[model samples]
Target: MSQQSNDEQGGQHRRAILQVAGAAAATGLLGANAASGQTARPGGRDDAPLGARLQGVQHFGVTVQNMDRAFAFYTEVLGGTEVMRDGDFKGAPVHYTLMADQEIVARERRVDPRTIGVPDLKGGAQRLDVRFVQFENVVIELLQYRDAAQPTGSGDSWAEPRDHMSPAYPRSMHICFYVRDDVNFDTFIADLEAECARRGMTQVRANRTVAVHSEQERRAAPRETNTIKIHEGPSNGWSIVYCKGPEGEQLEFVQVLGPVKKTFADAAEARRAATNRG
Candidate 1:
């Protein structure tokens, strides 16, 4: 067979696998740009205004203090498929580092001398290590700066009252994984919690699941309760829980009860049309 034919066959096989594993959630999480042949641009005014070309998240990166521990937690505990083991693909084992024209990272990170130290990688860095792991549709790039001075955590811990950080805090970001509502999600959480306990991982939030209510009703209700309010109307019936990853990165797990829509716009439009029909 021709190379083009072989490539087409390979793509079909991969799509079939994704379909069996719940293509809606996968495509929604990974973004339609990949499947639709749309090029993704950096988030800003440069991006298409209509957002039709926009795809979902392809992968996210996390800098780890200890690669082995993080790898174990993600793979052994969370069942992430290992794509590439820790290694440098380049024959010389070079560290790929870049500094923006205006030292953009330093400025954006708001580097405070008292809180964080600075590494003079202006010339460049070497011995950089990275690995890739796939959790269903999402690919997590685990990175480590071998020679450069990289902090272990974000320096804001929930345990530390003075330096505590929450989702409400600025620059605090998190990643969420989707679990099927039809499957034994509760059992899955239990097993995960047990594995974490076995590995001596600190569960920041002991509660496994939180009930969600609609936006309007939840807005009026007290916020101290165990349940969390979800603004996405399509995600109204889902249950969610939060936990701390190996490197103190915030992680979340969501069990969705409603149909997983491709985008929030689509979900909102469906609700609007339904109301009009009614």
Candidate 2:
């Protein structure tokens, strides 16, 4: 959504959704032009496919039923800092841009998205609340709309979900984070659950922290010559666990024994400089 909208759709004023995302724009998030609501082309070259042209992810969009609850859990429990927040986006540019959708004939049938509007009696983000929380390397975009669809929970209770769509189902997605070297996976899980209890948030559970094997390592390892133990399989000390976030958000944590290599972005920048010189 364009943070500062210059025009109105019908008669509603547009919110500055993009305005608040200046950091993302400067950092090449999603390869999008935040100010203009368009795609961006990097390197002054079309050397890559549209997807490859992307530099990095800006944030994960999460629609939550309770922004306050979600905010507390992420900040207090998960160590995220609120970077930017805006709560008045209903019927604004953000609504049309981020929430609006168009239909394609090849797709399945559904209620027309255009009909879903602000001031919607049933549920919409009439009271649109948006928050950007910054963790070490990733950002979480937490959103809450006024009248939403069936909420993810029943009420003021905290427990593993009684029922949920299996990850096997299409469109199911999860977020993963790298467990810090100073933190033990098992201890992290223990502390995580304990923290939630103290905060009166939903208790979390992590399944296992098994070693990452050869096959998985090959796919996930960085493809650089200065590489270290990543290719050595379980000997690399890589392990992972799956868990549920405070509000049942799917999460994964991994630990890799490593002398962290230069990030791919840094490597790519060097390559770009070399190419430009040549």
Candidate 3:
């Protein structure tokens, strides 16, 4: 199946699991009460290890132009929900949108341009526009500034300023996402490449990890340029690669090693595997 299709399937599977789990919880049939005779008090400690336990991601903020339009895009295209309205940030009226999957809750908040660490234009203070969208442990912030006269940077046209970084200098900043394993990694990369081609987006270089530099080399590196190092991990199952997502957002796709994985490692492995297959 296509990568998008796979993603849809995975999402459906997760939603089903969550539904079952939620039902079980409501009936006291899945947690400590179900597994054991005793129930721990609220805020009580458990014997589970940190690594084995599930920790949730709190929230990430993004800026956007029109809250109505952005909200529609996220909810219609990305399967997010409009949880709260007219939320407050620093006493400023803001919108708080929440999206969730089985594993995490993504909280999106709108911000005024003046609130971000940028100068206010028009010789006056104005609120910035921001939006947050979260999905399955991932939080994406979309930012849009109110004042056009202010010194602003470019970003993926579809996304607001805060959703991305200034692309004036290429390879300066990027976001990464981790995949399950090599098979899923390969599927995702292929799917993305195909989608880009279909959408007429150009394909840049793709490769595996290698020892290209160290901290010393990085220090000596020129101001306008830097090396992108790709190297194999201990298990060699996970990999990494960099690419530009819609609206020119620097994105890194990582293939995770074990059950729980990191986006960087996953991207490195995916790049490597793609290179080898090619």
Candidate 4:
């Protein structure tokens, strides 16, 4: 083919991609509605109706500055197991493109520095060094954007290390991890506090045990046996503490005491039933 023909074909392909992206973007609001358990349309005809597809929290992600430091804190301090690590994601085209948004926008827009943080929306991110660590039942993904034209603030992109937010804040989201009631919450907190002190990590809240739940938990229990365990002690209910990760990302550790003993054959089924009841 001639050079002119090749350029024209490329332009057509780019335009087609943008068209599809625009359509998906238009449906963003409906998707949010569905996620919030609302049927945007009546009689279940809504294509984006809320579905009980989610079984449980699979993972939560945080963007960090140093992969190694984050790994140490999560693995050594929090008792997480390293699942996988990708120092460079160049070989994975689909994953890299999804992260970088090279295909979402035309080549010209990619050079714009304003296009940062978002890959599927309007901006792109540099190829990242990603690490996945399993913290008990949930996985935590730590990401570091490499060579991206983005701000390297000490804290969040806004450079605020508040580590918390008001309930009214639209961007308020925090990852909470669970600790076993059988395990001593005080000992766990003491060890983690010592680790943070030694490593110079910001300890948002010190080791403190509070009666976070009492009658409410007992009332919620399905059986008398489960109720007997509720609020018996610091280990029988819940104890919580807050700490910052390598890049000042806020995390919470929760100790659930007297947890129910019901077992479900299918977690998804239980989740769906819970959703319906809610």
Q: lDDT per model, in order?
A: 0.53, 0.56, 0.43, 0.52
Candidate 2 TM-score to native:
0.62
Summing lDDT over every window of 10 consecutive residues in candidate 2, give the lowest-scoring window. Answer: 152-161
State the lDDT of candidate 2 residue by residue for 1-278, as single tens digits: 45433344322332453544554753345433545676546655466456544555777877665567778878888888878776544454445455444333112345554343324311333445567888877788876655343343222321123366446667878888877777656666666766886777653655432334553452343322112224443344555666767666777776665533234446778867765554
After TM-score superposition, the amount by which residue 240's alpha carbon in candidate 3 deviates from its true location, in angstroms, is 1.4
Model 1 TM-score (2 dp): 0.54
103 in model 4: Cα distance from truth in Å? 13
Best candidate, lDDT: 2
- Measured with C-alpha atoms, the lDDT of residue 193 in candidate 4 is 55
Clash statistics: count for each candidate: 1, 8, 35, 1
Instruction: In angstroms, give how far residue 1 of model 1 lies from its true place.
Output: 51
Residue 264 lDDT in model 3? 59
lDDT of model number 2:
0.56
lDDT winner between candidates 1 and 4: 1
Give the per-residue lDDT of model 3 (tens digit) for 1-278: 57865565455445444544553443333544546767765654355445323333344444444455445444553355543332111111121112122112221335443243332322224323344455555555555544433333232222235443544565466656655553545445555555555545442222323443564453344422321323555534445666554444466766656423455557768866754453
RMSD of each: 12.7, 9.6, 16.1, 12.5
Q: List the residue pairs that clash in candidate 2.
A: 2-18, 3-16, 3-17, 3-18, 3-19, 123-147, 124-147, 125-145
lDDT for model 4 comes to: 0.52
TM-score per candidate, chains pooled? 0.54, 0.62, 0.38, 0.51
Model 1 residue 140 lDDT score: 81
Ranking by TM-score: 2, 1, 4, 3
